[model samples]
Target: MCEIFSKILQVPINHIKPIDYVPAAAAVNRPYDCHLSNNQLINLGININCIGFEDWWKNYLNN
Candidate 1:
């Protein structure tokens, strides 16, 4: 989820890189996965701003 991390860390999309392992929560501040699906969707022109649970909550509350 580069989009999620970009939103969380306040960084640009290209700044995120794929990792082979999911870092421990303590190290990363939250569990993260390096699935390629999100990247694929982005390449396909699908805007994915809410891929994770926290984003879902934010969207729900905002609505």
Candidate 2:
């Protein structure tokens, strides 16, 4: 997933960092958070390879 995001962001894969958070898996719900959009990716200099991005982007969305 980091590889995919890194590619879209035009950044080195090693530069991608994951955010660690405890999920409310039992009862209490976690607070809602904003999601990343393609526009934001572009602003950050993403590539949008126009071939794999559509399918690859979904891989991280589930996380």
Candidate 3:
């Protein structure tokens, strides 16, 4: 999912950052109850565009 999202967004895999909730999820101290898996978090970030959004939207809408 992360790979597909990255390709769709034209962003490199390494450039994608984890969502802010990741640390909070990890700090829960419950191994069995996972808030979000790594791949899921990465996919979320890719979907949300943690760093780039305004520029992409501008260019996308203008074009």
Instruction: Give lDDT tens digits, candidate 3, residues 4-48.
Output: 556556778996676766665567564785664468767666553
- Badly placed stretches (over 4 Å) of model 3 are 15-63
- Our tally of clashes for model 2 stands at 0
- lDDT digits (tens) for residues 1-63 of candidate 2: 667666566678665577677566745755789665689778899896664664656655555
Each prediction's whole-model lDDT (CA): 0.69, 0.66, 0.62
State TM-scores per candidate: 0.24, 0.24, 0.23
TM-score of 1: 0.24
Q: 12, model 2: CA deviation in Å?
A: 1.0
Clashing pairs in 3: none
**lDDT of candidate model 2 versus the reference:** 0.66
Worst 10 residues of 1 by lDDT: 26-35
The list of candidate 2 runs beyond 4 A from truth reads 15-63
Candidate 1 lDDT tens digits, 27-59: 646457755558888889998875767677567
TM-score of 2: 0.24
> Which residue pairs come into collision in candidate 1?
none
